[model samples]
Target: MKWKTASTLALLSAVSLIGSACSGGSGSGSGDSEEVKDASAKESKDPVELVFYSMSRDSEASFNERYGDAIRKKFPNYTIKYIQRAQGSDLPDLINAGTRIDIHWDSIGSFPSSNMVYELSYDMSDLIKKHKVDLSRFEPSLIDAMKQLGNGAIYGLPVYNERMALFYNKDLFDKLNVPYPQDGMTWTELDELAKKLNVEKDGVLYTGFSPSVNHLFLTNQYSLPLLDKSAMRPTITNEKWKQVLELQLLQPTQNPVYQKAMQANKGKILDLNQFAKDQSLAMFISSPLMPLVMKEELSKFNWDLVSEPTMPDAPGVGPQSYPGYFAITKMAKDKDAAMEVIKYLTSDEYQMECAKKGIMTSLKSEEIQKALGQESAFKGKNFGAFFYNKFPAIADKTVEESQVPILATYTKNLNKLSAGEMDINTMMRTADEEASKLLDGLKKK
Candidate 1:
């Protein structure tokens, strides 16, 4: 799992202070003390090399071009050295290898363990107060999510957040003679719209909706947990989870579009390109990244995006989550220097630059929003849809190793449910029982 790569280092030149201590009698002692003090001050003032480990594989050249230039201009005394590591690689092993990584930058989904990161609550609270860092500048959801992940102990600051939105093909809606899905509509309402769009015409099957089931659970707009942490058991047998699965699981068996695609594609799920470039899907829910990926094919089809469909039960809450977070590692050589780097990266100037470069900003400012996607391939699209959703309280992360097996069991049960071999109750109960066994086995080991 190792992908170790190092980028060329950039040195910042600083003038070194020279001192002399006269060598004779009592005056020499005082001169020696003064010389020592001057040396210490000079050492403190000397340029420091701050090693930054970014999880993303942006090469040193691109990093410098996009962000390093701004960073270097702001902190001339500290040189930023980009230390590269592949995502999901062994972070502790890299630390043990004596790599001087001062700051850690990674997506929220790929965050390193607490054993690797320094608990920043005490240190950052002081720095935040001393620097008068405006906590209000960042979105409350971003801050709250970080706090929740750390169990009220802040270990990181969010760099950027992402929200799920519903993208629809305008051409498909027009062809189907159905109105476009509106913002703030419930998922139930979306289901009806999807049914209307599921029509067969001219040898082409149009999919009304093809949302990712995994996304619904991961995003968990309803704050549902697959595993009950306290009891250390699976909770898929619950009514809430049953409804969640029924929403997407039954679609494949019930929807003509999914059935036809599965038959034609040899049992595989619907092809994403069918939805993106082919304009066969009337509506789909996904992150903002989709539009960026389909930017070239977008203009070929008339399409737009809206807020993620609301939860019918909950009404207006949306699942908002931060994608990237920056933290100072426990093994950092210069903690204060790392904090300064984080501060600079999250500052208004840096954020504005990021916004102009089409990088999403974690800061909550009208100016930044207006500037977002300015340089992106989706420059003129509905970038405003990103903010329409409200952030729900983040649920605790499931950390058990058995999560892999649990998800497998759930997938297997989904097949059984689809084949009519098991009812919803049987599907959930069997899945939960198998997941509980896996968890129990892991605990014993």
Candidate 2:
């Protein structure tokens, strides 16, 4: 509700300002006129080169195919220059050399860690107002995420989004005579279904469920913060975290059959590969990109997807939004041009194209949602599952950069907890302690 109000107010303000400028009222001075003219010229069909740096390790070819080509087609007069992450031309290298980076893009999770950490972030609030870019058009959670990262300043616009879903090997379910997972199944229901599928067959153990635990923690449906910024400490020792661990890790690992399977794999946790490649995993909760990423291996097995399982107390809520963003960096020579490019990228027209190409859009348009995966290799699959559940509100980051290492520590402890080496309370306690130590060490540096 707050996001909607904020966006509405912003839109109204931009409109009012534009109307006043156009009317040339007494308040509109000569300088204001020049500024308006300059802004208009920036959006015109003028030839300009924009250098884009991607921290997400997007290759030059991939960038061109996915975005560069489209941008060039849209603005034929514009020259697109892409600099991907590499050994010698990384962010630090570019910054040290004073390279002009007009736009910097990355997943939201990594944006603050890299771009913000380097102080390369440029607040796009004024540009957003000048361009009348309607933030309400995007998924509310996505805009909220960006605002949280910028501490109320608009830093970037979400280009696309990704979310977790329940991917099931239909062949495995048929083989074991278990019903397929449904869309609105709760965690308890999913656990029961997993137990039915976690049986030994043909001398091979079939794991019922193998979720990406890291993703689960990062995008938990409860919107839990991983760290306490005020205290500069980890929040892993809380009761909510313990409940999450018990449901996601402890309960599943408590199965003796699952433990035996882990032992056979030499204590390695079963992953998505086991589901896609080995076909020994029944249900795997993962991102929708899996369909395209593992197209070949997945084609060999009959599979379908359902909405990600929900917590009983938070029914129908899905994981928090994980979207990639397009940000205009502070090093840009022409901020207006950069903002224009970003505005175009997030427009409804481009978002529609992205959806048609089987790319998930950050917009909340029903038409775009329906067109999802329409042109992809997996068109006939249940694409509706992706939108079945409501995305949970994103939690504000505390120590934004400390998340990765703390999560790593928690993940390691999770393995131990699963193997009966530590109880849930002990796991949480130790993880918090280790995370605190890690934060202290980082502060010293």
Candidate 3:
């Protein structure tokens, strides 16, 4: 089938901002089962049950409905179950206790390679090569990142991908007679657009803009890992860090809309509520899942999305893509069956179904993106907006591992900076000193 290049690029861009992992780097099923069946008969036997491990109930349910059901229907011998928990919680106990976990599926960064997670190249390599499952279909950066997790071994395959974008209220834009946000807009442009939308009507305040600084600078888009992994120290004091901090600091924190909501609620964080429910927020930066979060209020106001604003220096690059990955374990009773399941999950038919449900697929196919959100209640909305920006490449392994710790420390200091307790310079310096000390201690231990 001839797929449009435009659609593929759009999905790639959207996936980047939606937390689907991607970097500036560069699927199938059926009679294929025979190849694997011949290679290994253990997985072909009946009464096989597969465990889907994850931290989100929604992801678990989605996987069951979209992937698991399809897998069962395709291979009647298998049963799929879920094991959900907090990502931080210890799971070695369950795995070591002889629990039959064939597939380890969870969001990006949720499952780090450790004693519990199995390395895939040795066990699944033969299957991958035999099936001719094209790993090149994925971007080089993504494969590189996954391989880095296990010393250049394949540990998992991405099931779905996501990225962030600017979602806006069309009603608010019309109500204020301001032009809506456009694609390819820079942060400076967005700030100006937000300024125009910041106003009041009928005593209800409308916030022009309220993108979280932590999200834009410290977490998602335009964020780099703040630790120097080789040196075991924080790079929080870098000028780029200061630039990010200053960019947000220069903006208005509480637009009239947010302030009004806060006053009405009294000491509560109503920013998200304002954006999603109250319809007071003009624009917010978030994932395409925003539609799902605001399903109850679907028709309350007309909304649309645009690519997240980009940094001037980093034109076109939005954020790193973060998505859930599915890996087969070496300890599975039916390694062949697990490989088959992985193949099915990343297949075009299955991934297209995912797109129809408003979920993002990591498969780099325009046909998949064209099918995305087609059957969703959000159908006819600006799904293309999700793909407006380019995805940034994930950094090296050391930086990737230290992201959480560095972000954690910077988050605290960011709070102080926002609250006026510390100046930008002071905040950056303090975050650097404290994070360096913290990482140094961790390295020693």
* Clash tally, candidates in order: 0, 0, 16
> Per-residue CA lDDT of candidate 2, range 159-248, in tens?
778777889999999999999999988888889889998888789998898657776578788988777756767878777777777777
Candidate 1 overall Cα lDDT vs. reference? 0.60
Which regions of candidate 2 are displaced past 4 Å? Answer: 1-42, 398-404
Question: Using alpha carbons, what is the TM-score of model 2?
Answer: 0.89
Q: How do the residues 152-266 of candidate 1 rate in per-residue lDDT, one tens digit apiece?
A: 6666777655666778889999998999877787777888888888888999888787655446565667766557767877777777776666665565346756577556655
Candidate ordering by TM-score (highest first): 2, 3, 1
TM-score per candidate, chains pooled: 0.79, 0.89, 0.81
Greater TM-score among 1 and 2 belongs to: 2
Question: Which tens-of-lDDT digit does each residue in 1-445 have in candidate 3?
Answer: 1112212222222332232111110024422455554543444456777776543333455445545556666666778787655444335656556665667665445446332233322335577776556787664556665666556667677777777777888988998999999988887888878878767678877777765544644334554655664675677777776666555444544355545544565534334567767788788776666565446665678988888777778888776666667777776666767777777666666676667777766766777776667887779877876666766665444423433465566766554455455688887777788777776676566
- lDDT against the true structure, each candidate: 0.60, 0.73, 0.61
Candidate 1 residue pairs that clash = none
Error of 1 at 30 (Å): 44
